[model samples]
Target: MKLLVFAHRLELGGTQINAIDLAAFLRDRRGVDVTVHATEGPALELLRARGLPFIPAPDVRLHPSPARIRALRDTVCRVRPDIIQAWDWWQGLEAYCGVHLPEGVPLVITDMMMHLTRAMPRGVPTTFGFEGLRRQAEAAGWSRTALLPPPVDTEANAPGASDGAALRRRLNVGGDAVLLVSVSRLSEYMKSESIKRTIEVVRELGDTLPLTYLIVGDGAAMPRIRETAGRANAALGREAISLAGAMTDPRPAYAAADIVLGMGGSSLRGLAFGKPVVVTGEAGFARLFSPETAEGFIETGMFGHGAGGADNAALSGPIRALARSPDLRTALGAFGREFVVANHGIEVVGDTLLRVCRAAVGYRPGRVALTADAARTAYFYLRERRFRVASRDAVERG
Candidate 1:
């Protein structure tokens, strides 16, 4: 089947990465003709390396841009794909608007976020990242929804996939130091607070144990994260918290790490690298992956939500234990690699997507329903833009 995969952006983010990986798998392994469409970023290199057919998407200055719609429409006319798979809800909406009513190609959405939005069309076949969110979509009366967990490329991310010695030497990490790495976007929404708390935990423990926290990635929260890292380093009287900025492929860092601390796709990649992962999430959620905790992560995705607030103590416990025992870390790391290869391997996820697409083909939404979905999404976009402006004005006024 010919497929057009719409990546939200070709950046070093989870959802887009998953989209690209799946596209490659489908084309090379499953023999599906696939093309990727996206606005280019650092991940452009990765895409080119994968050798997939590429279509440059129009740059976005705003949500639901007319130019973007026109661009997608033109591409759809040229490619005439059997199915258009969009990586997230916004891209899904864009694809929905771009396809002509008479074309009748199905638009399938894959949303990786923990929450759902009312703006997505109920008629489209949607796949969520976790089982809990899929059940929530069903409960909300969405017509068709499935669970497609974010996939990890086990071969590319496996232990010894890259040379860790070079990275360790460049970072000046000592042999005895416990190298803790977190590869994330550094976004403020769900990551900044947890990142800062992790930095604090590293600082508190640095006095007694050899510890180094390596943060990998850059975003809006960079300033805040840098500030926190500065304070932590000052308290430790050394550079215990290191920032490696960002990389298109973080395999070297992952390979070099003694323990990984992160959420979502980053956590999964850590496991793929045979590194023990301390899954960190919003509101002070941190847990070591083991047989007991495996089921919970599988059900809810590789993230956790806590009610109270950020607690540094909660994060420190697991890191401290891992730092103390080499045997425990080695055993857990082996378990983690086995678990990821069994459950979240890219080939497994690619087959599931193929099944979803085969089921979704030849299905089309009514004109009235399509129009309503667009209207609802437009209204939500406008409201969101206004709120952003108002918040910016308030900050400026202050």
Candidate 2:
């Protein structure tokens, strides 16, 4: 079957990367012709390198964009796909607006975020990365919902896939020092708080153990991370923590780490690299990945919530225990790598996608329902925009 995939953005985030990787897999391995539709960004290079079919989408400044809808409508007519796979709710709504049932193409929307919004249209096939979210979606009256976690290319991210020694040399980290790394976007929301706390914890730990923390990624929170890292290094009179700017490929950082600190797909990628992972989340949450903690992460998608907000000492204990015991690290790393290969491997997820697509084919919703969804989505977007504007004004006044 021919497939048209809509990626919300061609940026260096988890969802877009997964879309590109899965598209290539379905095309080459599953014998399905797939074309990716997305605006040009860093991840476009990945598509080019993988030799996947692509059509550049118009840059979007607002949701439900007229230009995007027109472009998608034109692309749908040209490609004549059997199914449309949209990466998130916004793209799914755009597809709903652009594609008509007379064409006989069905739509599947995948949302990987921790929370699902009420604004998303109902009666369409949907997938979530977390089981808890999927159950929540079902309780909220969503139909045809499936739990599809992010897939990791185990072969590509496997142990020793990249030059760990070279990365260590570049970071000026000695062989004896325990290296902890986090590969993340470094944004203010859902990321900067834990990262800042990790930097402080690493500095405190450096007083007793030989350790270096390397953070690999850049974004809106870089200035804050830089400032915190600088203070930590100054206090220790040594480079206990270092920041590496974003890289198109982050396998080397994963390979070099004795311990990985991350959440979501990044944590899974670290596990694929045969490293012990300490999952970090918002509100001062941190937990070491082990058999005991595995079930909760599997249900919640590799993140957590802490009762008290943004505590500095949240990560110290777990990280310290891992740093002090090489044997424990090796055992946990082995467990993590095995878990990812069995559960989240790319081929495994590709098969699941094929099943979902087959089930979604040729299914169309009622015209009246579709029209209602469009109206409801428009109202939600308008209210959300107004609230954002008001919040910004309040900040300015303060």
Candidate 3:
């Protein structure tokens, strides 16, 4: 089947990267024809570089523009895809607004990476937030929302498969030092404050055990992070921190670390590599793996200390203990790796997504009869004309 994927950008973040990976996987494994459309940004260049089929979607904007929406609708009509899958909230809105599909064509929406419910509650601006998209989805009358977790490249991220010691040596890390790596953009919504606090706590723990903290991405808060690192280094009496600006390929950094201080997506990647990950954010959704439902192997702590913050005291003992014990790290990492391989591996996620897409395309909601109670509830609402009244009110308000 032909699939047209929509994403706001093709940048190296978890969502964009996963969309690309999914496209690649679907093409290679299922022989599905795939075309990626980016509304804006530099990710288009990366998509072209990867030899993926791409179109510049000019009307796809963060905000509404009727003219642009018309242009997008025309483009969708020309492509005539069997499935149009929106990667995130912005792309989802654009897909809902832009696509004028034939009767058989299906529209699928996915919240694959960051959860808006979690991010917005932590003070991220509504303009760039998922809450905005959630409102759009509700307003658009889209009933189905699928949760597509990011797919890790298991072949690359698997531990012991790569030479960890050699990677560490290449980074000039000493054999005696315990390395803690975090790979993410330094942004407030991403919990940069937690990272800074963690650094300070680690420094306070002191030089009794040599430690190295490597941050592997740059963003709006880089300067502040650097300034804080400088102060932290001086207080600790050693240059224990290195802020390596963003690298396209983070495999080397992931391979080198003894422990990973991940902030969500990076944490998931670390867990895929069988590393023990400590995550702090909105407790319900920011986790790498769902401890409650995940196959009983992966161990991750969901900190509820504050929204978008880590539990410093709870985390400190674990960090020190893991740094001191390689055996414990190995055990925990092994369990994590098992859980990731079984669930979040690309093939597994891809297959699940494929099934969802198929179901969506073939869906006939009317044909599936509801039980008596559900039918009665539907009848009550219909008789009261609640939906018609609400929709009229919404249109009038608009």
Tell me the TM-score of each prediction against the true structure.
0.92, 0.93, 0.76
Residues 80-126 of candidate 2: C-alpha lDDT, one tens digit per residue: 89999987767777786678433446899887767776667667788
The alpha-carbon root-mean-square deviation between model 2 and the true structure, to one decimal in Å, is 4.1
Stretches > 4 Å off in candidate 3? 39-46, 59-61, 65-71, 100-105, 113-147, 160-167, 282-311, 364-398
Displacement of residue 37 (Cα, Å) in model 1 is: 1.0
89, model 1: CA deviation in Å?
Answer: 0.8
TM-score (C-alpha) between model 3 and the true structure: 0.76
lDDT (C-alpha) at residue 48 in model 2? 96
All candidates in order of lDDT, best leading: 2, 1, 3
Q: For model 1, state the Cα shift of residue 226 in Å.
A: 1.6
Is 1 or 2 the stronger prediction by TM-score? Answer: 2
| Highest TM-score model number | 2
Question: In angstroms, how far off is 57's CA in candidate 3?
Answer: 2.8
By TM-score, highest first, what's the ranking?
A: 2, 1, 3
TM-score of 2: 0.93
* Model 1 regions lying over 4 Å from their true place: 100-102, 365-398
Give the 10-residue window scoring lowest on summed lDDT in candidate 2. Answer: 389-398
Total clashing pairs for each candidate: 0, 0, 0
